[model samples]
Target: MVAVYGGRGPQTSNIQIRSIPSVVRRGENVELLCEVENEPDAAISWQRVDGDLPYGAESYGSILRIPSIQGGGIYMCSATTRQGIFDERFGLVIQEEFKRIVKLFIVNNISHSTSEVGKSK
Candidate 1:
């Protein structure tokens, strides 16, 4: 007698992105963590939807790290298993911090031997 068997592993339920910030400041490093229901059974990968990931971007099994993010865009993480595939997206906004410069004016009074300093931004 001969018997036939099918080999299949457990599938992942859902894909989740953990510790993702809605807004990130420029020149700051970003680390995206992808989580799956059955983590051991799923394979995870990361990429940018608009284009290729920024320069110096690294992707491991479940984490994607971008060094000093200069631009912001939509990023997607997908989980694949023998049964199916699941995906999740995150919108990251890059905030440019405005710098304020201070101008100071100094007035020296020789007669009074005093000095006055005024500051302005």
Candidate 2:
């Protein structure tokens, strides 16, 4: 007796972000990578979940590049194949350099003032 078996079909699964910075500086270029485990021909797409996509953002293959990361929000990547579709989300937190310096100054001044008040008492 002879038996015939069919090969497995394309499937989109184990979608993940290969690399992404936890914190991105304003006006800096950033690249986010999305990977699928089994499907090499999967089509990848990107979308912003929390806000509008940054200006000049584009996707090449499985990589999403932002010419300049202006604002911070949730970004999602979708991988589609013949068998199924998978998605993964990434959080992009943006920090402004000037804002950080100003915030530090304000916090230091507040602390200094509080210490002075306690000493006076």
The top-ranked prediction according to lDDT is 1
Q: Write the per-residue lDDT of candidate 2 for residues 21-86, one digit (tens) a residue.
A: 669898899999988776789899999998778889989989988987788888898988655667
Stretches > 4 Å off in candidate 1:
1-12, 112-121
> Cα-based RMSD of the predictions, in order?
11.6, 12.7
Q: Local error of candidate 2 at 13, Å? A: 2.0
Estimated TM-score for each candidate: 0.74, 0.68
Q: Residue 45 in candidate 2 has what lDDT?
A: 92
Alpha-carbon lDDT, every model: 0.81, 0.78
Q: Write the per-residue lDDT of candidate 1 for residues 78-115, one digit (tens) a residue.
A: 88765566778888899999999999999996775666
* Sequence-dependent TM-score of model 2: 0.68
The worst-scoring run of ten residues by lDDT in candidate 1 lies at: 1-10
Q: How well does model 1 score by local distance difference test?
A: 0.81
